[model samples]
Target: MSRQRPRVLARAPGQPQALPASLHPVLRRVYAARGLAPEQLALDAARLQAPTALKQIDTASALLADAIVAQTPIVISGDYDADGATGVAVAVCGLRALGAGAVHYVVPDRFRMGYGLSPALAELAARSGAQLLITVDAGISSLEGVAHAQRLGLKVIVTDHHLPGSVLPSAEAIVNPNQPGCGFASKHLAGVGVMFYLLLATRAQLRAQNWFATRSEPNLAELLDLVAIGTVADVVRLDHNNRILVAQGLARIRAGRARPGVQALLQVAGRSAERLSATDLGFVLGPRINAAGRLEDIRSGIDCLLAADLQSALPMAQELERYNRERRAIETDMRETAELMIEDSDAAGICLFDESWHEGVVGLVASRIKERLHRPTFAFARAQEAGVLKGSGRSIAGLHLRDALAAIDAQAPGLILRYGGHAMAAGLSLAEARYEQFAQSFAALCAQWLDEDALQLQVHTDGELRGEEFSLDTARALEQGGPWGQGFPEPLFEGRFEVQSLRVLKELHVKYRLRSADGQSIEAMHFNGIEQLRERGSLHATYRLAINRWQGSESLELQLLDVLD
Candidate 1:
């Protein structure tokens, strides 16, 4: 696959004067460009939107309170990913603290059962003798599963963050912000965020009934550590509500008040809890937890979070680390194969399949291809069932992936067996025999939907850093200014530099000693960028300011994002 040179543009300037005079000039400009007001920069937990704003939250909370009062057996059905794993941990811990007697969880096997709540999963939950079923991160699209659970004499409540289908499931209570008629202001909550909100509402209900008068009330704030991990791992937009949640969680972790599981995972990842950032959560810990669901069972990841002590959790974290290493190897091989397959065609959208590809790793492969080509790409692998192909898709801007899949499904009924996801990412399954048809249909849809401007890759930067601003203090200030992700992006700057020296590391990464046009020498690293550098002379680059800590000292470094002539 040929690399497309992206168009570089500066972000539109913002009303920096509107911000506090104490803020750094760069940060003021950065915040202003994102349209964040001075008050919006405050990420106190108290600033979070009230749970009462969520439609049906009261009903869901009352139902949960009743189950706790009756000492009913409950099962939490969670999706198989980082968000789902953390959400399960939050639910189990929060409910047990709230005086629930019996709460068990069920996660689908990606290889066997596939994603989400299904009739098969419901049967398994019913067999556990659960009278009440609560779904975390899933069940919005599980109409059949909800009906099946109800038929088995179980009351169902769904707490998902995914977009709902045309018809809502007939669960006892649905608490998705994106559902029709829901007035929740933050529609971008992750699965874990929704579960955390539900817990808050349930705690309030229990308090209203004086259930906590005789017993100790649980500090729901203690669960924010897991909430932060899941929210960032799931890659949800960091709206004001989410930023508050993550900020609180980070404070707890920094204060050494996080759960044993989180501490143990951080230990394994070699990240310091005191200086952890949202980037660490997304890139360092998220992948390790998600590796379990992708390759083996998500229960391992959940068990780590549920562990009572670091000694008990370390082994599980190590297991997750092993799974992550395996996942990386599988992803690399699959990506190479996909690149070879798409070397010939220049379709607006891309679809690739290999019988040898692991079903669990297709999503990562799709994400890699989509990032490289800036196209909506799907990668498929043969499912456990013969003649079935399971696929995962990642989309560029201007394409709603789930909506695109829905359009294809509506235009040709029976083409897709199952599908659900968000705007940028989604999963689906179809017959292996229909691969060609689905490919052509997907390509046609993307071609029809995307225009030249949409297809062209673009990188927006926050202008350039002044010579005096290129310091460790500046990097630290920028780092402190964000719990950034998705909609709230981290600050990126563009500049021209003369390459003083360059060296290739392991034949993949390029390490450069560069002299900025302002005559300051700086260190920069371009990971997996050996191919992008043809002329080592003067070059334009977009990068993020970073603090590189080694041994005991920290220095300013630039993490290159893109390079241009």
Candidate 2:
């Protein structure tokens, strides 16, 4: 065993085998752990949440209306991620439809720009003729940049979802649910979700001022397709409010009314808008959009979202697909290298120093190693810029990765030059010479918090689903109930299957068929698991269930999760 697995909380001592109304007996335990309820997930439109409940949307509306009337040259400052790009696209499309003047957007280049609104980003916006700057998916702690923009005579309206610093930027208006004193009920909104709220507010303001008396409402809700995709890709929790957004967007997609840009992305990802699902966004769309930010400029991702026609969207999606393919190649190469470095080192914690690693894909490589090795992993790569060593780290649960890095800085006083992030993922920078010290200090902190319990990898699964239960009908229902990601997970089900046969498609991958004891046989592919399955023998597995189709034929297939020999 890599590390001893945990005893997941099982159902009460002797629970009933079958569940009542709504939940299939098999999914009852899963939904219970997933923090969902039968009533909450009903597919009826009546179950959907409304945006009016969030306070201060009225203020957002007024700000948007003022910008429209004044013809203020507006600029949207976005983060360099798919969610950031989608948020920017929504703002541009919604604003132009509502009569906002000369709206332009800028995304932080991952290589040149760090993250969020910096003085450098402010300078870029200043020269763009922007009198009013509206931040999308970024700019909560841009204290210095917001001040810089203010001094340069630019009024700022911020719409973001990141945790705010002790002091917020002195913008003309700020609309972040996490901001101090905001009474928004749902704190789970993603960056794009915040942008959607701004659109809602803008509509309310336009209505109040009779801006829509003669003109139409512009069907702002139609843009939820982009919002839902970005929200899930950015790994925002799918709360009741977010689920409504995602569910509604998916409904439009199923009805064949999705935005042209969203349809284009689906085709690029080898999915159809007419068959959209929460899984498609998380696994397919998310990675492709993220690939653009990781390896190239996020503007291409945003451009795909903003593209007006399908013909125009094809090349953009193709370009993004190419970037994603290259990104995967880089990740594979770097991951293999990092694995060797870890085994070679006798160090307590993992810190792989590879100068030639691609800076853009290091974060992903760090995450992969962290999961497989069951230890925190920091993957370092050379920065294109001089005098900087870029580092990205991912941690196992119970270890506050960001806090540990902060503690390293605190202990030696300025040992770690700069860092930022949350509990699970983090990014940092230090001089090349200080890498060893940072690693040592980070190891020390982890040793304090971690115990035997924290080392084990626990997979909490909803158990034993049959092929009949995994039908497209059930899949569609499950699809409607999600925008699942970081906090809210897509469903995972376990099954006891006998390996009927296995074919080595490539030495690394196995094309296999399995039959459930219930006599449900399904075709499944275990990607890159030939060696593991060969060593482990015919297996019992816990996997994510989905309806995979081939050439117009649809049936249930397992997306491989965890397998036990």
Candidate 3:
């Protein structure tokens, strides 16, 4: 197969640019395109919107504070993902720091109780003597589950970030920024971010009531490490507010104040805590934590994050590495098989299934397939429920996966048994026999909703860098300019380069030395495309500046994103 060059468009520079004259010109333009003024680029905790701005946060905090004073047994029910794991950790750690009595946590086993605060989960919490139930990363649409908790005599506090349905859960207090009527400045907070906000509010409420007169007030900043890990791992849009949370967390880690578990994870990944960045948090540490949830159980992940010492955290980190390795092996097999399974059909979307596929790893396979094909893709595996299959999907920029699923359900009622997710990703379940039917309906919806242009991939850039600006200083400046992720993407610059030397690396990656028009040479790499994109002459490529570190030395390198001869 030949490599396809995506259409490239450069973002327009910021207007009436108020950036400091001392700022790098290239980065000044890039930051402007992202709508960041010079002052707004500095991430501080003060930049975070007041927690009280979130709907019902005060009420939620009051309830939590009261429960703590009354010595109530609280149980945090979490979903089975990094966000849920970190949310549980933050809630437990923060609550304990606040002097809450008997704070406990339970993460649902995906194979057992499914996601969210289910009725079954509520029963389990009740058995544990939980008088107050706090849900993280889930529960906005869990009407049945919340009602069940209420029936079990548990006061449910829902702290989630997923989009809510028309009918909200009748929980005692809800603290979701996406919940209707919330005027919170940023609606893109991850589950951990919401939990952190709640902790902040709870502290203030206690302080106001003189509850901390004798006790040293817990500095909530200590929990930002988990917040940063979860926010990036969950792949939520890193808006200004979330950037503050993540930047703070990264600062803490680099200052040697990271939680023992995070430190151990850093050690396992061979990442320097002093040089940790958003990329390390998202790609390095996040994957190790997520691996436990994907291959085994998320409880171990939560336990790892909650580990109190390096000695305890190291073993858990090692266990997570094992799980991640297993997950990668399964993903490799599934991805290769799924690729061969693709036919010459003209469907607007792709749906794949295999009875042998592990449900835990289907999401990873879907992400891989979507990246390869640039199509809305879904990968399904057999569910524990008889005659049912669970499917996880990833969407391209122009399509909303969940909305497309909703459309399919609306057109052929009962076609989807259950589903929910964000614009870029979603999960759903249906009768095993309905795979073909659902696929056709989904394709039709995609065809109706997406245009020809939407199907074609496009690579947006921040324009080409001047030869003088392509130095280590410029690269490091860009690194310092971010806590970039998701919505706020790291910069990619496009330019034509003369191939100085090119070769295949380890039979997979494309390695090359390229010279710019001004005769500046730089090392570049494109992973997993050694065969598909080989070119002999000058080529236009979109790339990002990256710091190549080796044996305690650092140099500038380009990570090739795409190329056109």
The top-ranked prediction according to lDDT is 1
The reply for model 1, stretches above 4 Å from the true place, is: none
For the record, the alpha-carbon RMSD of candidate 1 to the native fold, in angstroms, is: 1.1
Q: TM-score of the candidate numbered 1?
A: 0.98
lDDT of 2 by residue, 304-343 (tens): 8888899998899889899999999998999888777776
Among the numbered candidates, top TM-score falls to 1
For candidate 3, list the clashing residue pairs, or say none: none
Q: After aligning candidate 3 to the native by TM-score, how far in Å is the CA of 564 from where it should be?
A: 1.9
Q: Better model by TM-score, 1 or 2?
A: 1
Give the total clashing residue pairs for model 1: 0
* Cα distance off (Å), candidate 1, residue 338: 1.0
lDDT of 3: 0.89
Model 3 stretches astray by more than 4 angstroms? 1-4
**Judged by lDDT against the true structure, how good is candidate 2?**
0.77
Question: Residue by residue across 133-235, what tens digits does model 3's lDDT show?
Answer: 9999999988999999999899999999999988999999999999989999899999999999999999999999999988999889999999999999999
Model 1 lDDT, full chain set: 0.92
> Which residue pairs does candidate 1 place in steric collision?
none
User: Please, what is the TM-score per model?
Assistant: 0.98, 0.91, 0.98
